[model samples]
Target: MVFLHARGITRTVELPDAEPLHILRGVDLDVEVGDHVSIMGRSGSGKSTLLNILGLLDAPTSGTLEFDGVPLDRMTAGRRDRTRGRNVGFVFQQFNLLPRRTALENVEMPLLYDGGRGFWRRRRLAAEMLERVGLGERMAQMPERLSGGEQQRVAIARALVRSPRLILADEPTGALDVETGATIMTLLDQIATQAGAALITITHDPHVAARAQRVFRLSDGVLHAEEPILEPAA
Candidate 1:
């Protein structure tokens, strides 16, 4: 099934009574379950804008977006908001953790947003997610107390707390050192695959693109389809 399908999607940002700035140009793409895709491009190539549109965080200026074969163009704002939280998980470049909150609290935040169940209910699920990312012992630690990789682990736990169908990660490894980045990517692939969720990652690094099943290059506000990579050359 196509978890995401975009057809001739385009976006143009208009300033105060000025000509519009064209940010996206008739981009079409599709993703399926069990697929891991990496979107790569230079800055100002509209990589992040495209990611936002794909994740349903924003609507295209024009064109159709279908999720699970249902047209999203007609979906109401409230419905779109709920759909995004329920089906799409996001991991940002910055940890974006709550500094004062413990790792467990941060992880459980998503469930709370979705109106999750009783105290024990959320706690059990949060604990399970933390453990899955090897953060069992860091649950009670505050964000500042955790290392870079550990902080990102908490972020991933938070992303998966409500069990989303797709994971959108933009520069998830940007802030970490090489060693930590590798570990984080390893865990990201393992958890997303285990949960049967499609992963769409946007990174500027060639090596990062090499990690995905397929890598698409976007340039001049256009996305070009690409063949699958059997494996990255050693």
Candidate 2:
């Protein structure tokens, strides 16, 4: 089943004093449920721009985007916000958790925008998500109290608490040490796999790209793919 599809996508950013920069030029892509794709590119190569468009954080200057068969070009901002929250989860380089909030509270923040679930149920779900991310012991710890890896775990917990069908992670390991980065990716890969959510990660490191099932390289707003190695028969 197709979870997300974009065709003939193009995005242009205008500048006051110079020519407009085209970030994505006729990029086409498709992602089904549970597929993990890594988009790798150098800085200024439009990898992050593509991710932002895919996550609905920014709209394409011109193109068609469909999420679960729903067209995105015509959606109002308010509707888009709701749809994004309900269908898409985001993990960033910076954990972006509130400094003053406890881990539990941070995980519960997404529920505040939702109205259907009651307070107790939201609390329960948040706690469960924290446990799943291996942060149950740090539920009461604030952001300052947690390590970089632990904070990213809390961010992942926050993203998963919404039960999103798609997770878009932008440089999720950018701020951590080698050991912590590996740990974060291991936890995220496990969590995303268990949930059967499609994962789209954008990164500059080729090693990071190797972790995904398929990898795409972006240059001049276009995509290129290297032949993937095949595993031996069991």
Candidate 1 structure quality by residue, lDDT tens digits, 1-234? 788998898989989989889988888888998689999888888889998998888889998999877789778998888899888999999989999899999988877776546344888899999999998998999998899889999999998888889999999999998778878998999988889999999998666777898889897778886665453454
TM-score of each: 0.93, 0.94
lDDT of 2 by residue, 1-234 (tens): 998999988999999999999989988889999999988888888887888889889998988999888899778999888899988999989889999999999999999888686355888999999998888899999999999899999999998888899999999988998778878888889988998999999987665677889888888888877565343232
Q: What is the lDDT of residue 119 in candidate 1?
A: 41
RMSD list, candidates in order: 1.9, 2.8
Question: In candidate 2, which residue ranges exceed 4 Å CA deviation?
Answer: 118-120, 229-234
lDDT of 2 at 201: 91
